[model samples]
Target: MKEKGFRYSILASGSSGNSFYLETGEKKILVDAGLSGKKISQLLAEIDRQPEDLDAIFITHEHSDHIQGVGVLARKYQLDVYANQKTWQVIDQQNLIGKLALEQKHVFECGKLMTLGDLDIESFAVSHDAVAPQFYRFIKDDKSFVMLTDTGYVSDRMSDLLANADGYLIESNHDVDILRAGSYPWATKQRILSDKGHLSNEDGADSMLRTMGQKTKRIYLGHLSKENNIKELAHMTMTNHLLKADIGVGQEVKIYDTSPDNATPLVTI
Candidate 1:
């Protein structure tokens, strides 16, 4: 029997690497390829999927943390890569080295809608240090999902784009108090706290609250720092704020965390 809903999984997530798998009955798409091709293959194997099952990759930006394995995955697996023109320039200048070109890498402009296999994708600009960082809204049949990570701040524009998503993967990068007392260098600390750096727990919670509604099903917090925040604290911070807004946990919506080292179970719609 065919499954009633779309399926999504975080192959791995963190500063070391980031990758996600999404399947909509007939089509499969990977959101990012941060891990090595070998590691990615292993992760897929753990979930009973093969590398060849992937249809394409949607890059949020050109950051090493998100594209570390992109070139290798695309070249070896012949997976189509999609991103904006600026991302392409940055990707091209980077040391792809001996990695396979795969073929002409596909390009799509931010704020435009496109079709990938049987799924629909809408790209939007997001705040970050990388060239043309973007967030994605994906639709398949009647289900809608969004992936908005690597963003420094939440904006009205981003809120509008993510509104009413059935599933969301958003960045919750740090805890403010922890970041203030952490031992990192002053310059690096400043960058992380800046508007173009990373999202704080509060920032992430606020964005979720803005998009919270009866229809939103799941929210997976992503890209948390190893040094500055603890998983429980990050979850509590967002949880408390959302509760104050009268968003009941496991009632109106479900919240999840993506570990920095490995994959989470497939989050289905």
Candidate 2:
């Protein structure tokens, strides 16, 4: 049965910065703050929210792309930042001021479910180059969503975390062939293909097929590389593979690619 009241939306989604707002029970939590504080404020205003409305900020990693605006937002909003020790270390390296430094932040290991207001937030390790990149699975009422991005490989544990999600925000970075032939240097290409690197489009689709359930409602393809992949190709590849698996793409799932430069219309769940 669906929860009587629960809502979520992506404030912004793309390679530059990622942020999402989840309203569970009576709490408003932001999953990340990678975009500029000014931009975040504008986006939140569009959704009828202010920075003060956020209860906390949950960080998935310390990559520059994910934490670029953390420093400014934290100081301005005084938001509680949640992350693990390793992630904190990387953030500290950025030398962000005030609340973004992670010194007075709350640190928690991945793989445990924690409650914030009425929401159940679970964090799990992901295969990325960052000190401790993590993925999130959020449950509110009876609805749940799994956000799996930035990782090069999907382990059994990650698969388990995603197995029962109602929606998925999965990374479909580069098309392997396109990446292989692109202008990026060989070393950079090798880095992206490593186990602890970014996930390619095929890898994302493969992971989705492995973890999807009948309850899966939508797939939001995210974190696409601007250099070597196109949104249409990612969509078509995933669609074809899902068909071969006896899964009618739109029958049980609706797949949408994230905007490479801006936010897609808020996906309410």
Candidate 3:
């Protein structure tokens, strides 16, 4: 029998690596495969899934933390990989994930909708440092989930595109104060705080306030920097913002934290 609802899990999320798993009863897919194949497989096992069960992998960019295990997983499972042409080009140029079979390489245009099994998937461009970093939205029936991470800032268009999602896996990469005072070099800090860099917790909170609606109840704060942000801080940052907007956390919306080493519990909507 087919599953009755959409379900997903953040297999791993952070600067060290990133990956997400989603299933629509008939199809199982991974959004990124940044960790080693063995590590990804182990994470999958925690969720009662196997790497071989994936039908495809959708790449967001050529960053090593997002595509590290893509080659191995795709080659081992003969799974298709989808990415924008520019991202594909850099991935190939850098040999980031190693060789992928011609058949397994699939180029998708951003801002276009593609259907896969029971879901409708769409990718939209984001303000990130990478050549072609885009975030994704997945719709199954009336339930929609937005995966918006790695972006330095959320544009107005992105905010509009993500409104009223049922769930969001958004980046709350760092705290501005914490990042500004961290041990990193000045240039690195500046890069991280740039328009093409990762979003600060304040930026993320504001973005959520702009995009979240009555239908948006669940949010998974992702891509937190261990050097600059704490899990509790990210959660509190969003929670406090929501409260100020007269939105109830846990009552009206539930916020979850994702980890670099652990898989979040399976979330269904």
Candidate 4:
């Protein structure tokens, strides 16, 4: 059965910035705040939410695109900010987000489950070129949602932990061919294609196949590359691959596209 008032939305996604919103009837939280505080607030307003309504902000890593607005929002709203210790170190060393009050800082260990209001949340390590990068799984009642992104490859443990999720916001970052032949510097290209880089469309599809199960239905393709991927190509790549495996794209699972410039409609789970 679906949990009432349980919903998730991608506030913004892509190489430029990323943020996600998740809510239960009693609580609201943000997964990241990469955009400026003003921009994030505007996006929240589009979804009939405000920064002050959020209970916490979770950090995936110290990458600027994943943490630009974190300190600003945390200070302005007095929201708790959670990150693994290593990630916090880099953020502090670089002053990436700015000053965060001691009271607003919360450190979490990967693979541990944390309870906040009506949600049970867990974070797991992912292979990425940042200090302690990770993704999250959120559970409410019997429904589960996985926010899996910013990883070049899915680890065996990640697949095990992510299995049978009801909804997924997974990375479909680039197309291999386009990224290989594009105008990016050779070093940049190599990094993106490396095991610790971002996932290509094909890799993303394969990872989804490995993790999705009977209860999986909703999929949102996120963190697309502005240069190496287009929404249609990423969507079609996953759809065609699923079809080959006898999984009906529209019938068995509904796929949604996220944007770097706007927010996706809040989807109930």
Among these predictions, the greatest TM-score belongs to: 3
Instruction: Tell me the spans in candidate 4 whose CA falls farther than 4 Å from its real position.
Output: 1-5
Per-residue lDDT of 1-269 in model 2, one digit per residue for the tens?
Answer: 43454676677666777887777557888878778888888877876778887778888987766776766787777778888888877676666433444453888778888988777888888888887788789887678888888888987766875796788888888899999999999999998999988888889889999998988888988888888899899998889889899887887788987763455565557
Candidate 4, residue 172: the lDDT equals 99
Alpha-carbon lDDT of model 4: 0.91
lDDT of 1 by residue, 157-257 (tens): 67876788888887788888888899999998888989888888889888888875668878888888898888888888878987898888888888898
Off by over 4 Å in 3: none
- On the 0 to 100 scale, the lDDT of residue 7 in model 4 is 88
Q: Who is ahead in lDDT, 2 or 4?
A: 4
Residue pairs whose backbone atoms clash in candidate 4 = none
Candidate 3 lDDT over 95-180, as tens digits, reads 88888889899998899899998889999998888998987999987899999988888977789878999999989999989888
Clashing residue pairs, candidate 1?
none
Q: Candidate 2: which stretches are off by over 4 Å?
A: 1-5, 96-104
Residue 160 lDDT, candidate 3, scale 0-100: 89
Candidate 4 per-residue C-alpha lDDT over 169-204 given as tens digits, one digit per residue, 9 for 90 to 100: 999999999999999999999999998999999999
Best by lDDT: 3
Give the TM-scores of the predictions, in the order they appear: 0.94, 0.92, 0.98, 0.97
Worst 10 residues of 3 by lDDT: 1-10
Tell me the lDDT of model 4 at 235.
97
**Lowest-lDDT window of 10 residues in candidate 1?**
95-104
TM-score of 4: 0.97
Better of 1 and 3 by lDDT: 3
